[model samples]
Target: MAVVQADGRLWMTFGPYWTGIRMVELDPGTGKAVEDAPVHHLATRPDEPYAVEGPEIVEHGRHSYRFASYDACCAGVNSTYKIKAGRSASVTGPYVDGDGTPMPEGGGDLLLAGHGEYVGTGGRSVFKDRGSDWLAYHYYDAEDEGTPKIGLNRLK
Candidate 1:
């Protein structure tokens, strides 16, 4: 995922699920990672051996929040995917949850999860509209024969 920070720097997070995910600075003009940019771990699934996916970064107030999908995905109602998050003061961070546990060491605040007719609530993206922040994502609708459906929530 990519985010344009308040200071106009472009940042991105990416990596293989089985290995790990990390953040890197990008040159806005060149659309490429800055040479020799330091890579910082975005997160690894809490209590699991693999890293999370679908990373999203958003800046709010004095902190930058990173969101990622954990568990599994694309299995319709059987999917175990859920969204988790962490925040940091620096864009390239040692992000931590509300309890102050570091993200790279398997710590994140539970943000969204499967509930009721919705299963696998993940693949989230955050955007601003009309001066307000909004979150958009997809979920498997169990009541609708496990069809994937879009969901949105206003970030407060």
Candidate 2:
């Protein structure tokens, strides 16, 4: 689990080591602890199973929260790697897609996958800057082709 410090609140993204992505809110006034808060589901796909790892959250201003997750469709194989994203207005949300579909039922946008220049990119962490967002993860280098290395890149 990782917590992000936003304007006046604390937002956290968490997931089962082998399952789903969820978001929670912490009370900043109470020293950054959840105040009877419930975790909100952010992403899940039926066709893929095994795990959802490395959840990171970023506030896109004051009202939007974006959650990024690495989907391990099949554990132990680079071929099954993929990354997905979801967004919500509140810390706790019924996060919907561009078409208004909920996550657990296959919502959100596809961010990246093993098929790209970087193979097996997973274990992601996201951050916000002056006006941009970045994604940090470990990827299997295409040059070495089989060795994994850590990388950080701006996410447009």
Error of 2 at 120 (Å): 0.8
Candidate 1 residue-wise lDDT, 113-153, digit = tens: 99999899999999999999988989999999999999999
Score candidate 2 by TM-score against the native. Answer: 0.75
TM-score of each: 0.92, 0.75
lDDT of 2 at 156: 73
Q: Distance from true position, residue 38, model 2, in Å?
A: 2.8
Off by over 4 Å in 2: 27-35, 73-79, 129-131
lDDT value, residue 36 of candidate 1: 99
**Model 1 deviation from the true structure expressed as Cα RMSD, one decimal place:** 1.6
Report the lDDT tens digits of candidate 2 across residue range 1-156.
Answer: 877776566877777756677777877776465868777776666554545666666667555545555555333335456667667776566666678787677776777677545677777777777878888777776667466777788987
**Ten-residue stretch with the least lDDT total in model 2:** 70-79
